[model samples]
Target: MIESTFPILEVADMQRALAFYRDALGGVVVYSYPPDGEGEPVYVSLSTGATSMGIGLTESPLPPGNVMLWFYVDDVDRVTTHLTGHGANVIEGPVDQPWGERTALITDPFGTRLHLAAAISAPPDEE
Candidate 1:
């Protein structure tokens, strides 16, 4: 058997990263460890209820312009409004695509582009 986990992002600051993940993206930190003797994380992880990922502050800096993470939501308008209210920058739309979803792209303070997608609700079939 095999199992896979989502990737971790190396950050310059742990708390800042945590804020973006938790606040802007609505994720919760499922596991975290305080700094070791060297004052660095032993381990830390976050989740968006179903998906789990890690964070390592010491690994390396995130690339200059890579959209490394994406988040899909049930309501793009509400989520994007909340994120924008929280100071996230809206980069793209609440535009409907031919693929059948309304999507909006935004960038966090840490420069991660988060894609908010909401599938159009289907109407009930009439007899």
Candidate 2:
């Protein structure tokens, strides 16, 4: 039996998204396709350790942000700083939640809201 394939956020500016994902989120470019045999790429891929994603340019319309695509990272500060440096707007802070997680919101180039999250510190062990 075959499961269905998933979709990723394909942006018009693939290079910008690639840079943000790699430089900011610490994702590695695992795969890329050249543009008409030229060195330049028309499509790109990035992986956060194990999870992989795709990026490409398309004229299709994109809808608003959905909660399902949120990616939780280990380093919130680094991620926030990197995204902001590359022109992303931080919609919300690295605020601590009562449920024990530090979270933040960022607006991507395509107006997609990305939720950045990290687990809170654990309590010290008893003696």
Candidate 3:
């Protein structure tokens, strides 16, 4: 059986990715490899509450507009606006969905897509 999962995203620029994830998404950097080193960070671990994510620097070109990171937030409009103001490009609306969610699609400066959502109604309890 699986215990837990941590998603790692490869980024071309560590500083930009770190700023986006930490400053915009409110993620706290919990651990970073080569801490206080002279060069750019090779790996970084961040968390918001119980959810954790990792960012790693890569020499290869980053595949932008491919993967979407979904975040469930309290206020989709406010969060989307804040992110867009900080350089995220709005791709879709914060419109109400048939499944009962208000969502918005955005792309970061590096081309990573993000989906921000807020529940319009209580989600169905799991079986």
**Residue lDDT tens for model 2, 32-105:** 78744677666777676657777776666556546334678887777787788877788997888777778889
lDDT of 3 by residue, 50-110 (tens): 6998998889876764577889888999999898877899999689987789999988878
lDDT of 1: 0.74
Clashes of each: 0, 0, 0
Stretches of model 2 off by over 4 angstroms after superposition: 1-7, 35-39, 60-68, 122-127
Q: Comparing 1 and 2 by lDDT, which wins? A: 1
C-alpha RMSD of candidate 1: 4.3
After aligning candidate 1 to the native by TM-score, how far in Å is the CA of 102 from where it should be?
0.8
- Per-residue accuracy of model 1 over 56-127 as CA lDDT, tens digit each: 786566663564566778889988988887667899968887667788988776677778887775534567
Q: Give the TM-scores of the predictions, in the order they appear.
A: 0.75, 0.75, 0.86
Model 2 residue 70 lDDT? 66
* C-alpha RMSD of each candidate structure in angstroms: 4.3, 4.3, 2.3
lDDT of 2: 0.73
Candidate 2 lDDT trough over 10 residues, lowest sum: 61-70
- Give the C-alpha lDDT of model 3: 0.85
